[model samples]
Target: MRVYVAKSGDSLLKISETHKIDLNKLLIVNPHISSPMMNITGSKVYFPSSPISDTLQTPISECPLPSPSDLLSSWIPLTSLEQMADTDYDVLIVGSGAGGGSVLRRLAEQWLNSGKKVGMIEAGSLLLPTHVRNIPTVNDTRFSQYFHTVSKWTGKYLPDFPGARQLFALGGRTLFWGMSAPRMDDSEFFDWPMPLKEMKYYYNIAEKIMRVSTAYMEGSSIQEILLKRLHENGFPEARDVPTPADLEVTKYGQIHSDVFWSSISALAYALNRMPFDLAVNARAVEVIVEQNEVVGIRVMSPNKRAYVLKAKTIVLSGSTFETPRLLLHSGIKGRAIGHYLTNHSLLLATAKVSRQQFPEVLGTLSIFIPQTKKHLYQIQMGGPGGEDQWYLWYSQYEEKALLDELLIGISAFGKVESRFENYITLDPNKQDKYGVPKINVNFSYSKQDTEIIHQMAAALNQVSSAMQAPLIVPNNRQAICLMPPGGDYHEVGTCRMGDDPHTSVTNRYGQVHGVAGLYVADNSVFPSMGAANPTLTTVALSIRTADYIVNQLK
Candidate 1:
């Protein structure tokens, strides 16, 4: 036997191939090795005394081997066109975003050992590390790097209105989300089909999977001072913002909080131990329904070739916009197919905290102040850009002086009442690259929405005064600035969930009304937009839906 020191990126398979030994012999000699595919960098590997060609020259009948599919099960294999063709799946999940990803995870966990084929098809490409690593600045010119403007709605709304932004990747928007994991208030679910008690169980499961913690940035001096001030000033709702971040303090007291940005890709990656397939860059053009039951989906590939994927179950977890467009294209007629659209009204403000007030302040701190009225508005005490990098990106050049001693942000997010007028419809003339009709959003703020914004702004000002911080105005603005509609990117309520089939698109369990085996699990199923971020709720509800589907399959 010869000793071999594995170099970086050296796997057992590579080592065995390089050493010209049979994989079984290599494993027999290296009993301490845990996995054959694991990168055993800097580890010692033993080589058997066998000629390199001996194993290669062996008869295939004598040398039993695992199949190629068995060897590739360590990772979720990205399916190619040839592999996806002429195949059937037990469950076909469309849109590998947050909701879709969560449902896939739950289903994969439940049916991992059951040999059930759960296939996930995404309209976008695989989310690469490079795509999210180099996030563009919030400047107007560079904004298109991460966001695309809806061409049809460009000239319809006000000039100041910022159009909706959608990310076309395996993880979808979760790749670039702010990682806020706040839960909805019970009152927010008053119109939901499921009760609050059932949702709480799923919320607990999601919180664990996402690693959500309210103690994020707990030991920071700035957080301590801010929490004390808020509590003393009678703002009980001003507590630590729940986030999927792990806080680590160095011996030198330097704070480093690592955010846990859970995406669909992460969920798929975690299911490596399970058996599943994920097909990327496959956009669903239509659902093949027979006798009001979905049997297959007509998908178009990047090269414009269309094919049918047969499945026992179908789920549409596409975002609020794309899901509706897919349903309309599939001839799923309903009054609420693309209506009752709602998103949060965002108001951005900034404040400067003098160094003299609290000298021990360091790093960023976030706190949420909930309003007394249910489903009204919540005042967030941190900037959208969580870290110092984002702080420098959005802050004005003139405010550079206050960078060392600035609190820098206040945002008021008010719930928009769901109205029938705020709806989406397929455009008659416009079509995207896939020859599908483009979506037309006919939405405007209601009178109650305007009043809520004014109230939220005043409340933010009150907090600024109590904290003894002054406004940091950019462009010499004297008051709070309202960001254009869809700025928050928390759009929901397009395919709302309710008990009535005529009024809503999906039922309590996310099953499409009158369409067996067709489900909707994304934010499009929201009945109303709660003040909290919708990602957590979307995930929790998806978990619930997955359980329902599993029970039905049984």
Candidate 2:
């Protein structure tokens, strides 16, 4: 359990050579250190299995060494419910996904030196320490396989919501989310309950914390040439996709090992600000309500034992599906608690382009044709990838023996209307091991939704043709493929936010109607899934909600 505090001018090479530890073993144990040449100053390098003998020579350093505790410790500590039950929390977050994580980040940032108590409970145990794509070993193929293995396919029980899946880990689905962190168009929020001014203010904060940048593809030749083609040929709205990545370098003994952003990243920021009680494998089965206010949450342990954790406020970020289920199970009075389920109508088209179309240094492509007044869908085109449209940077692929074509994929997300008919309700006949009833979904695309899908298909064609990439269809498949509902993994609006008690579960501030201290902050709170990825907007709303909660406390 011995740890080394990395000092200036010290790296894995120097430490390995000086300490007589195998260099390969050092990398194996310290996954946090991405490269041997990285400046690991202010980092705690562990020697979990290495043995240090008394006969070994004393280590010499170019710079003064830091105390063990002075260096950065890269571990999230968990507190058991047995102890957590004794102390009350100011805010108890139900799930640790993007929504819950953002709420925790804002609160911890604001209350860094304060004594405000915060607690978070996650149903699943710690999975990946960061985003799956951030890991060096994970590529496109392994990414899909690994994600499928970890996440719970909740849609299996619901025939209508067959594509629905839930990853109940500490970081939730963010571990596998594609990092398209675009802000919803200002026009999209024209009719929202909250003011556009507040939404813009929170979006800036969310993007700042997430390190959202458009420079990821700035220097890439492939992106440059293809995007130019799109702009020249009718699709002038195309631009570089906004990616959530920490492009910062380490400096002055500070470490920046985590490059890709995830909820785990948010949790890390929160911990750096202040310690919060985090209990994993703690499934929230019911919310305890007193009169019309939320009192606490009844959480079930792995062994089926239930514990009630007291909190002045509770934010449900369990997700679009799980949040509604919990509300219905608790019998919380909300006419729209589980109604108005909505997801984007997804359309996909893939084509092959000549590899020689661009310069030899073929970097990856990520172009975004955003949702506009004329078009209700946004198109994200990326590739020169392999067989499908996997990002070439993250996946390994074999060259096409007969052809010199590069694969390009365009995904169009068409905005679907949030209808009251498409909703989720608990199945009284089914109860899980924790004694909570399962949820059933009644979802179908309306005529307007189907028309949007057609429009998305035409748009995808125009863009692909603009890039001079001929669309290719798989055997017996249409050129424009319409993915099933919920296939996008961007389902939303079950616990939508609005001012009406009968039409919305939570108000614009995210508080549940008629219920004080109960809030919804996940994808569930989005009134509509406006053809943009919900992660970025969800984080923005969660931050705004956190600010509201802070004001209430004050």
lDDT of 2 by residue, 221-277 (tens): 989898889889998889999998887789998877677789999999898898899
On residues 1-554, what C-alpha lDDT tens digit does candidate 1 reach at each position? Answer: 68999999998899878866678777877889979999999999988765644755677767768887667632346777556657788888998778998888888777768888778889887654322323333442234344453122342332323556777777788766767788987787777777789889999998887778977566666666877877777576788788875444555875332234556444644466467767888989998889989898988899999888988899998899999999999998788899898999999888777655555545456788764464389888773232243331232331323444565578888989998888888887888899889877888899999999988888888878766776766658755898789888899989999988777999889988888899998999999877888899999989899999999998
lDDT of each: 0.76, 0.87
Q: Tell me each candidate's TM-score.
A: 0.79, 0.85
Supply the global lDDT for candidate 2.
Answer: 0.87
Using TM-score as the measure, the top candidate is 2
Stretches of candidate 1 off by over 4 Å are: 1-76, 129-161, 246-259, 383-404, 476-478
For each of the candidates, the C-alpha root-mean-square deviation to the true structure, in angstroms, is 11.5, 13.7
Cα TM-score of candidate 1: 0.79
Pairs in steric clash, model 1: none
